[model samples]
Target: MSDEIGLILCPEARYNRSPIVLVENKLGVESWCVKFLLPYVHNKLLLYRQRKQWLDREALVDITCTLLLLNSDFTTAWNVRKELLQCGALNPERDLYLGKLALTKFPKSPETWIHRRWVLQQVLRECSPPSLDRKEQADSDLRDSAEKTRLSERLHRVLHDEMKVCADAAGRYPSNYNAWSHRIWVLQNMAQGNLKVLHDELSSMREWVSMHVSDHSGFHYRQFLLKALVRELSQSLHHHHAPWPSPGTSSPCSPSPDPQPAHHQANREATAAAPCPSPATPEDQSSVPAMPQLFHQEMELCTDLIQSFPGHETLWCHRRHVFYLWHHWRRDHNHHDGQGCGSESPQLNHTDAGLSSHPHTASPRGVGLDRVESRNGQAQEGQNAMEVDGVGIPDPCDTKRLKRGPPDPCPPALPSEHGFVASVLDGCLSPEQGCFALAYRKWLDSVIGQ
Candidate 1:
């Protein structure tokens, strides 16, 4: 045992060998690790099976921690730690710390992420009280409200710390799917319904996405936040309108009321056009900016990104989602306003003639190749002419007066958002760009055709 401890502590002695091999060869630690692990695991399984007292909590924790550090996918070890947590032998914070340490070694481990999620739920369950009983007295209601408020604050802190952990993991390993998925779960399940909090998160995410352009997870999270904001605005609008009956309302069976005068309609329109003050509280009856405007802003952000990363499939796919949602929203809004299918139609000129109007020309390499081909053709023609004239194929080096072909035509630029998308699709249609871009183009065409 002393030799095993020394081998673990001495970096020079541990060089080059795997940790398990070092233990097995230098100090014969495998049998010791298994000896300490198997009995504890068996005891826990027995207790779980027999529904008896969970004994030797400290020993179980020490053994399980060691085993898990060596092999994080050891489900039995994680189960033992969870039992320890339930039995009050281990605290939530300590479990979370252990999880973080394990994640540093195994960032992609599904078990580690699952265990962390379990710990978070345990923390939440302890902090928040049960929903108030309808039959309870007023005092119970007050207590429940206070407890909920406190719980919300604590949950906010816990989730904020977890977000930082996930962000760090993602930065270290950009393709860490487990870290990204865990962050999304936290946001969807744990975040409070506070617009200010959501807005701050949105600001942070904007910076993150800008820095990591190819991360689809970051972009997807942004979409989730935007959708959440839209839902909040909609709920607010519904609540605001629910209290007031329609202008001519009475009992449901009453005769219909007269239509409002044109002057009265004009006055209401004027009121709507004026700027309204921001609401003093979330529940106050104040109007949010129109939903289409929000979608338009997001669309503009996507356009900027697409321009910067012209060849990235993820960005293009995200843009497709944005457009799909935007079109649906517009359709709903127009229907609500009693307008028959919107006036602005979705159309793309899918012909080579349209390419002539695109502002950006073919890539420089393509243009260079065209120039080389034209020069070669002219040189070949001159040689053929010399042979026909019976000049005995004048010295090949003397054919230096080469005539150049007319320059490649410059295509005109398409300036609208649709035009930009169409141009990008055209550029990516080539085989070298891969199938993803082409498939997306086909999907876009179907959407426009609808």
Candidate 2:
């Protein structure tokens, strides 16, 4: 790309020629060229689009691609592409590929993500089955079943590629709001209620966030997945073990004992009376994943990360989220006694990993060096605070729940969010008492305590 043939003795950039820099399979166009090239392509594309000057589809596609790559923020360029998409001149997957390339450079480009979502919606709509209800599904013919399987496979491939695209974009830009938000959108729309897909995403993000510890967006995405899992488990547990009616209530049906032979009764009684041989028995290890255990494990992760990477507001914010979820979870459990719950995991003790507090509150407001995150998520990013796409954490100190401590009759003990926070402050000397730790404490007391 470096045009060096006619050098002006010093090999310097001039009006007609600019330098090109290449790094590891990536091309970097210097600003000298961008200043001129961008306006040329942009004006050409806009003029054609506005005046309907160029009805040539190939020229439109070519010029639009150049303009978008130069400035994906150019909404008119994206709209022109959308027009071509509507006319069936552009393939959805090809357009998606273009968006992926655009995101590689501009991972936080809202316009690029918006266009991508539109194209992805088309792909999803094409893959959806037509009028297949429960009865039809149950009695589907072999051909229909085969077609559904093929369509499912295609969707899975599309989602897998999209996940890769999001991951790459997230890596390119830390705390990438658009990339992570798009990731949430993909799961909610393409992989909704798919437990295995959710599990895989949770697994992959662990390694990713460990390396990018300060990524608030990544942590928020994790929050979104955890909520989905909680909702799923709660629903399943309710259906599987529906409560029995009270004996005091009137009943039309009679309850009769089984007429079993004496030997058979004796054998059943012998089996019923026998206790489980060991705590590790397969029967005792229920297949149901414990919701509380998951939360506790998440707590462990948060605390560990906080100690390891001191001074990151993202970690503290993540801690606040986990604590809020756990607190509300216990509150919810008390209110709905039979909600699907698992064996409680032990409290996450602050491992005095010799991690004493230090101070780094250089920024004003004592916010530390952590990246800023938008509290009110944008609608287009699919970062809505609703059940399906919600990535928000609840307020930890809601007073209604504070006054109504524990359930009516009370249950086994668990550490409160306050107790947990106190332990973290006492055990770890974050920053030798840095700005983030102190600010977090003040937030708990002044903001939350209020």
Candidate 3:
């Protein structure tokens, strides 16, 4: 089947061989024939791989598509396509379309996502401009610049399309691990340290997770974004002082994230900004939320989600990640400052399945979110009013002017993690039993010593 119409017809998650009505854009294959269809395609591809007289390259592509759309995890069939791709017999875009269609029914298929990543890397390579000599550049600077722009636009289009494909697969299957993982890989490979891309993703995902509260993978992707945002913020500062890489060459891509330069160093106790020789102007800071404000907004979101949708373990788990990241960021800052963790800090614990989380805490230090500083008015009106557009706005409820005793003690110190967990536990239906809440409470106690 041509990639332009490679959409799979299967509706079931399991083998992805269900029958669907044939359409202009979809592939329709009967499930009952899937049993006979696979063995036939398998033998035909085997003959082609063996270089049989009749089975040729076109026959190979035709049979592999039939095998993969039904069994998306067929590693050998994908490898055959990869061989074809390497031999210049197939286009990267065509293979990407094939992978997207394979993912339609088998959202969690490991090999399908893997092949997609490989194809994406090939696309990235194609997008990179060839190195040129100084004389060549001087001769055609405008042409070179235009060529670079074309490559950049092509890469951006592919990046956005891949993100959408991953989102759709994730939506089709809750906790679709392969989908989210591939999305992360694409960002790290294609748009590393692009703050605008990260911000856009976080904004769109906010609404997606709101609708799919039980999808743990969606929340996990959000956590990845939060980490990436902080890392990018810190990296921006480092890059400001560091010399740029040569314009003629592109940086080599890493398959996974590299060891970052202690990103949390700049974001202290989840409130303070990085101590810099020259502070960034307020206008420069306004575009990004203060680190504390980010955490506060996230905490508020967790509270609202838990209160609105009671007893979802995923919601409670999401809350755990928010606290865990906040706690660790503060500790990293403390370590950077030569002041060790205080008595209230969370002990190091196993995070994310069985992996050891490098440095993360699940508790706050000193004041809670109530007293945190703001860059975007995140419920900080009770604190000293911030200067706006060169004018320091005085507090409307200043005791000396309004005759009120005090501005109400900073909104009762936001709520301690313990208190927040207790409130969530209190709201759960008895039949629902709030097991997720109880588990989260136990997590707080064990990790944060709350």
Q: Candidate 3: where is the Cα deviation over 4 Å?
A: 1-21, 237-286, 334-415, 431-435
Clashes of 3: 3
Q: Any idea what lDDT model 3 has? A: 0.64
TM-score of each: 0.58, 0.63, 0.69
**Selected candidate, larger TM-score, 1 vs 2:** 2
lDDT of 3 by residue, 74-115 (tens): 898999999999999888888888888878778889999999
Best by TM-score: 3
In candidate 1, what residue range of length 10 has the lowest lDDT sum? 245-254
Better of 1 and 3 by lDDT: 3
lDDT of 1 by residue, 1-450 (tens): 111211133323335544454433233233334555556665655565476855476767776766666567778778878888998999887777777666665767789889988887787667645544567756587676565567666666677778787876777677688888888666555653345445556668876877787888778877777766555544444344322111111211111122444643553343332211111255322423334445655666766776666667777777777766654543343333332322322222334233234435433221123445677899778777777556656754654443334433321112233365556666654442345456655665565334
The top-ranked prediction according to lDDT is: 3
- Tens digits of per-residue lDDT for model 2, 1-450: 221111123323565654555555565665555667788887787678678566588888888887877777989888888988989998887888788777776778999999898887777667655666888867776667576667667777788889998998888888889899888887766765456666667778888888988788999999988877666555444444313211111111212222454643553443332221111222322433455556656767876787777768888788777756654554444334332222222222222111122222122111111212232224324433433544454444446758877632111112233444455676666554356666666655554333
Where does model 2 exceed 4 Å of error?
A: 1-25, 28-32, 132-142, 239-288, 338-450
Candidate 1 Cα lDDT to native: 0.57
